[model samples]
Target: MSGSPPRRGSALAADRAEPRAVRTRERVVRALFDALAAAPLEELTVARLCRDAGVHRVTFYGHWPDIRTLAADVFAEEVDRLARVPEDVISEAAGPAELAAAYERALRDQLREILERRDVYRTLFASGSDAGFRRRLLAAQQERAEAAVTQLARAGAEVPGRASAYPAAFIAGGVVAAFEAWAVGGATGVEAAARAITAQLPGWWPR
Candidate 1:
């Protein structure tokens, strides 16, 4: 006869396991980020990552099927750090000017964080890197842009029908390009890049 399947665990055991799992994952993620910062992604391998993470090969595999999947998660987490803005900042804005001001302030804060992780941005956005990573980054930015446009419209800003989405797409692409340029040393500084991106928005707005 075949071996019996594993038995179910108690609720208390599962509760304890959850925090341990989280801690292990966090250690692995931090190690991955450190490794990426030290070398190009193309040079990275599962064995090296597991060693650097101080995690067993099985543990790493338990959390991620492969290095690429782990990489995508790292990229997404970094992108999210730059994309999230507090809702309360714009929630109370009374007009387009106020909303724009709130948006600019929020963007500046995000840009500061981006600059702090300049090395990661430069490596990830560099030419000849994985195309899939670029697509994921772009998709994340576009999602945020769409949400921002929707919020502006809900806040009484005049978003012209059918054409409203155009602004979001344009802004998202331009912002990403500008940041990439800045990260690669093509642009002067973070503040200048942020300003340049914000300046183009009014042109894209329905007028």
Candidate 2:
């Protein structure tokens, strides 16, 4: 007889390995973030990152092929965290005022996260940095913004224009610019930045 099919949970556990491996991966990524904040990505080496993370070079290799891969993973994780905020903020049942309040809350969450990681974000997105990395990060944000627009549309909200995507892309670009300014200390504060982003959304949703 053929071998039995792998159990679902067992398959997942195998993919993730044990808790120790997960912790090590987290440490490696965190170390990369810390290291990148202090210097450019070109300056980082696997040996240095391994030393900083207190993990073996073999372990680092097991998790990622190179620093760029690790950087992509870190960006993906950051984007996923930001995406979760909108789920709590937008609801199908929310009225116009309620939706506005929720948008404010979500905007605050996004700005607060940027402030918390200001150094790292500035390092990654600063002009003359890694073009690929900046493009990936911005693309992720655009995807998130597009997803948010889809959610609003599904909730029976009236988005501007026959092409909802145009507004979404515009909003995403504005958000990126706002965060860049805030990251560089051009914006007055997190609240002000949040207000600016929140203002842009009002026209997209029925008020």
Best by lDDT: 1
TM-score of each: 0.71, 0.67
lDDT tens string, model 2, 1-207? 779763322112223467886898779878987897788676789899999999987777666666765675576457446645445556544664565456556667777776877765666566333334456656777777677666666767677763656866776677777667777784547777776666766465654
RMSD (CA, Å), candidate 1 to true, equals: 6.3
lDDT of 1: 0.67
Q: What lDDT would each prediction earn against the true structure?
A: 0.67, 0.66
Report the C-alpha lDDT of model 1 over 1-207, residue by residue, as the tens digit: 669653221111123258877787778788877886788666778799888878887776666666665676566557656677677766777765677666676667667755776666666676334434566667778888787777777776776652556767777788777667666775446677777777777543432
Query: Candidate 2 regions off by >4 Å?
Result: 1-24, 33-45, 54-76, 86-89, 127-131, 162-164, 186-188
